[model samples]
Target: MKTKLTRRLLCGLIAAPALLWAGVQAHAADIKERTLRFAFVQPKESHMGYGAQKFADLVAQKSGKKMQVKLYPNGTLGGDLQTVSALQGGTIDLTTMPPGLLVGLKKEFGAFDLPFLFNDFAEADAVLDGPVGKQFMERLPNGLVGLAYWDHGFRNVSNNRRPIAKAEDFEGLKLRALQAPLMIDTFKALGANAVPMAFTELYAALESRAVDGQDNPIVAFATNRFDEVQKHLSTTRHVYNPLMVMASRKAWDSLSADERKVLMDAANEARIEQRRVSREMEAKALAEIRKKGVLVTEVSPQERERMREKVKPVTDKYVKEIGEDVVSSFHAEIDKVRTAR
Candidate 1:
């Protein structure tokens, strides 16, 4: 009886190791070696570029060098709009774009385009990382899968006309606003003649006096060298642009469960590093813009309030369009973050 018991114990131990080995093999089998193409508008030196490279490195490492990401930067694949359309058509694998650009795909995404919606990164992060943002991403059409949100920093207004220290200064200024309705309406309500245009055409427009000014993050102004064409920079901090990293439904559906995990994990890890570098570079960029002899104005809190009041109608109009529950949940999440501090 003792001899029989010993043999059974040995057999059970051996089977346990075999079972574990089989599970590992099954997990590894799900990861197929394939290359994914990632496209973005920024150059290799920008935060977005760094994040893309980091994502590539992590994907390769985690997938045992089996899965790779090929990058196309500097809008090599075309503008933000083109990139999204390509993703839906399976011509592109992945891309990161401002949520405002997603408004055409899903009007609910316009909630993020609302100026002054988030007071700071903490609030923005809380709302975006919470349920509301997740639900919004899940609702995207045409197989677009939102993996994570990265920071584009707070957007400020810059122009060749004059310093925008107050809302009244926006009068008659031809500002190159984003093609999104909320963006166009925001500037319009502030009394500027908002000219909707593509980002690729912006520098030439500003230089040729087609548009008097434009609004973007300081990093963009510095990186794109807008300071050379525009004479004034106002730290309006009007909009907090959240960059959304997305995957094509065609590409994503083809991936195995284990492969999807690797991609999502790398995207989130890159997001942390991207936001850190973006905030750091934004500070340096603003200082450099000042040194370039561009007039920099810090809009006072009172003046900002006035500007906010001016755009209240635009905000109110979009609230119903963006849906009541989602925006309400967003405000609640933001309020939670604010009170947490």
Candidate 2:
């Protein structure tokens, strides 16, 4: 009986290795060797690049080096609009951009551009990761596949003219705005002469004095060297930009189920690290911008409220355009997060 028990234990141990090997072989069979291109407008050191690289690394590791994601940063492939077009045309595999930019493709996306819509990162994350965000992605056009929402930080104003301490300070100041109607209207409502322009063309526009100011997250201001050209920075935090990681539907349709799963898993995993790096870099970037001699000013809570009031009409106009049901649901999600806190 002792010899029989010993023999059974030995046989079980011997079969374990074969079972593990078979499982590995099955997983490998579901994947294929493929390469994907990811392009964005930010530099390689920005949060966008950091997230892209992290996702790429994860894909390679998960696929046993059978997949590769090559990154193209610094608008080398073109600006956000052009990149989106490329993705739809199946010329590019992946890209990330503010959801506000997709207003042209889906009017509901304009809800994201409403000024003061989000009070903090926590609220924004809750909405974007919740049902509202999932529904928005599901409504995307046939050419795009929404993967995940990544961080782009809250936007603030920087100008060569003067600090934006009050809503009145925006009057007559020529500010470069994202090429989205809602964004232009938001700036216009605050009394600025909003000049719609692509981000890749913004630095030259500022240097040439074509636009007196621009608004972006502090990390963007520092990483893009905007402090070198702009003299003042204000913490308006008017808009919190959440970048959407998207893939070409054409490219997505060609992938195996295992490959798609790998991409989705990697994108979500990278999102956690990307948001952490973005928030962490913001303080350091603001300090560096100040050290570079840009006057940094914080808008008082009262003043921020006043600014929100000034943009109320613009928000109302867009809420109508974005559909009341959608807007109400969006605010409901935000309220749910606020109440939970």
Candidate 3:
């Protein structure tokens, strides 16, 4: 009887883990297995791609490998406009794009395109992760959901011509601008002949001297090797670009509450990682670009102010376009951040 009892006890112990595993799987039965597509315009090794992969890993882990996220980087799917349309149409599951690219969907997003709006990451983080940011997210289109905001660093000018020391330096220079009304207006207001174009075509355009200059974060300016084609880089810091992580409302609606929680949590976590890496990369790229013999010009405080004043009218036009209440709320949020500091 003792020998028989021992055998039964051992068997029970061996079966215990299997029973627990079965229960856990049963509990997660509502999470259907899926293969989702995530697309972004940056290269696979960029901060954007890193964030996407982080989110994908988190989803897979939390969902017990039920959800597989396939990544399409380097604009493999399409440009930002096309990606946004695909997300809205449910052809794509996720994307991370600059807010300026989203103006067509919600003009209020143009608020982010305002020159010199954010002094640094602290101010930006305070506004974007707080109430004002939530307001923008809530107003996103019916078929799209804003997940989180990641840093795209500050926009600076890179040119094949002379360095921009003041607002006047922008005069008559043809600059390739993002395909957004606010961006075009902002550059035009600063006296540059802003040529709106897709990012994918920017390199060849620069090589062909189709545009005299362009503005982007240092990381992009260097990583895209714009330094090779351009001779000067000015630290204008005109716009603080933020990457908006978005999800398709159709894909979001199809998920169970638990699945949604996993995705949301993962996005927030990945945001932290993405911003940290972006800052590091920006610093490294700046050093690399300088080593390449590019004439790096640092715009003085007075010149920065002059440039800001030049574009003040552009801001005024967009405030009305973006709605008074939204702009007011944004200012109120900024005020809170300043006071807290």
Candidate 4:
């Protein structure tokens, strides 16, 4: 009986090693070796670049180095609009941009572009990580797959003309605006001649005096070296831009389930660190810009409120276009965050 029991134990140990080897092979087979292109408008030192790099590292670790993400920064692949089109056509694999850019594909996305919608990063994060944000992602047009939401930070105005200290200061000033209807309309309602332009061409436009001013996050103003051309920086905080990380549907469909899971996991994990880096950079960038001789101005609460009230008609018009249900759900998410605080 002892001899028989020893033989059975030896057989069980031999089978265990074979079973573990087979499981390892199966896991490896679930991820294929491939390189994906990730393109964005920001330089390698910006938040977008930081997030993209973090995501690439996570994907490589998770996939055991079988998959790679190659980044194209500083609009090397093209402007945001061009990149989105390339993604839908499967010529590009990944990109991140403001949801406002998708307003043409789904008008509901316009709700995100509303001026003065979020009070701070906390309110923005709660709303974005909540259900309404999920609905927006799930309802993306057929050619795109939304992976995660990342920070772009709040936008402020910088110009060569004068500081936008009040709603009246916006009168008759020419400003470069994103090529989104709501964005253009919002600036127009604020009394500026809003020129719709691609981001890639904006620096030259500012330098050539084609537009008097433009609004972007402080990091952009600093990193893009807008201080070299523009002399005034105003803390408008007019709109908070949240970047939507997206993958091409064609490329995504080609990925194995394991590969897809790795990409999504990497994107989300990178989001936390990306936001922290972004918020931290804002103050530092502002100080750097000030050191470069750019005059900084602050918009008072009363003036900001007046600016918001001035754009109410534009907001109301878009709310109807964006669907009342969607807007209400968006507001409810924000309200929940505010009340909880």
Candidate 5:
């Protein structure tokens, strides 16, 4: 579970721009802008792609054809890492992506990857939608603009090898990671030899035995075609990934205030739609993944708890590597959740 980003994050990200552009009056005249491109990875049927399409539709309707958001899905925009860089460089206008990828842009984000941090989706929503969420959002302006967070759901383990009934089953296996440092460390703690690689390259990597296993939400695994390679499905639910939608600050400034409102509202609408759809789709995806000839390994609760206890040090080291306050705030949020009931 990641510590929430507070309003401080919201304010920081919207902090005063250094210098205003001169041609705002001229740009305002052209209210009928042709099209705006929103990028996402995965195929059109995946949550990322579907939500992006919904967002585009929202913006089109709200703006009365003044602007259109064209979606470039299925890596047509590029891989996770490449697309984020493109957004920062203003080569891309918008994108829906996993927040874990943003950790490279800000180490504080690693706090989100701590093992056993969140118990369920409700608790996660409480932190992210509250001050903690706003605080995390604020940190993005230093590198990229922060938008609403979309759920990627609980991450489970899948492999063609033996059943991971306990932490020991993961030992010596090479697991694919989203090229993030914390994930590499997480798999290492689980006794798996972790391989950090691009998301787009993961399928081929697994098929070729370049990596033996990968962890992801069920929807993502099936959507990305990894089900075709590795045949084992382990519902380890090790992580809860949330998608971050952002716009290029440079591209943002080029639009009129009204134009920006249309885009922002569209993004927010997309965020909500994406979360609902993912919440619904994961079960079907899980069922479908099971039908696709992959063995589903379910880790018992006792063993899952044992794995969490064993990974305590991974959490500790990351707390220091990220920031103590970030970790503290997360624990504090959990405390509130525990006290709530």
Candidate 6:
């Protein structure tokens, strides 16, 4: 009788934990079935908005309808600052934004956006796909996990004034820049007197002559219709912009292991698809911008060299401020790129 009682007690102890575990999974599943909201500033027509939607769709599919993401585009949720603020405070679950805005939260992120740091998408991809991106992602906490960096392509100067073949032309022009600190400093250093503006406000600012010009990739200019108001496009390729896709830490913690795996897998898949779309559309966007009456200017190699020389000090100062180790890692990644190839 005593042996039978001991055996019965052992069985109940083992079964109790399994029953509790099953109960937790069911609870988590219920929580996961609710909506997830993502925010970005661009319109749904733009690739930035569409790419984010693609990510949402992937998450929904992979999670077997366990999650659904609702997108807030065109500043419906808020501008970049507000969106990031929400993400940090757990008021927003996800955001696809340029890394520039997050620098206040992680100053080392600024290192990724330093003027003229990357020559093109290939080099940018290599660096972002490697250690530089890895470190930047790990540097943030607020439940921020940088799943991948989407290319914003190279930024060029667009103006209603004459073509800019030299740096002197930038003097006194009211240029519109993304509220990026380095971009503000870089344009100021060039004597352009830039006004930082949100994307939603840019067209009106350009149309009313509140700002004389703005900068973005040719593809973005054409697709987003910035080329319509702006009369000139100079291939300055000033900064290599990358979109950071992040999720809220608070929301992420409540998820099960299976749910986490599904979300991450979907993000990885969306990145691969987004890269292909970016490349396929780039040349076509450039052609379309030219067709839209935007006079495109190509600075000669010597002229580009002179511009780089001018911005070199701007780059050096940021490195000093960020840290020696960060600067070293950045240079090592850049050293891997070559123009001749």
Number of the top-ranking candidate, with lDDT as the measure: 2
Q: lDDT score, residue 18, model 1? A: 69
Which model is ahead, 1 or 2, in terms of TM-score?
2
lDDT for each residue of candidate 3 in 170-252, tens digit (9 for 90 to 100): 99999999999999999999888999998888899999999998999988787778887999999999999989899999999
The lDDT for every candidate, in the order shown, is 0.88, 0.92, 0.88, 0.91, 0.80, 0.78
Pairs that clash in candidate 2? none
lDDT of 5 by residue, 188-272 (tens): 8989988888777878888888888888888988898888888888888778888878888888788777778777777787877
Write model 2 residue lDDT over 1-341, tens digit each, in one string: 99999999999999788766644753666888889999999998998889999999988877767789999999999999999999999999999989899899889999888899999998899899999999988988769999999999999999999989999999999999999999999999999999999999999999999999999988889999998799999999999999999999999999988889889999999999999999999989989988899999999989999999999999989999999999898889899988987
lDDT of 6: 0.78
Off by over 4 Å in 6: 1-31, 141-143, 339-341
Q: RMSD of model 3, in Å?
A: 7.0
Clash pairs for candidate 3: none
Q: Report lDDT (Cα) of residue 315, candidate 1.
A: 93
Pick the winner on TM-score between candidates 1 and 5. 1
**Model 4 lDDT at residue 328:** 91
lDDT of 1 by residue, 223-313 (tens): 8889889999998999999889999999999999888988999999989998999999998988898899999999998999898899999
> If scored against the real structure, what TM-score would every candidate get?
0.90, 0.92, 0.90, 0.92, 0.88, 0.87
- Please give the TM-score that candidate 4 achieves against the real structure: 0.92
What is the number of residue pairs that collide in model 2? Answer: 0
Weakest ten-residue segment in model 5 by summed lDDT: 17-26
Deviation in Å, model 5, residue 221 alpha carbon: 1.1
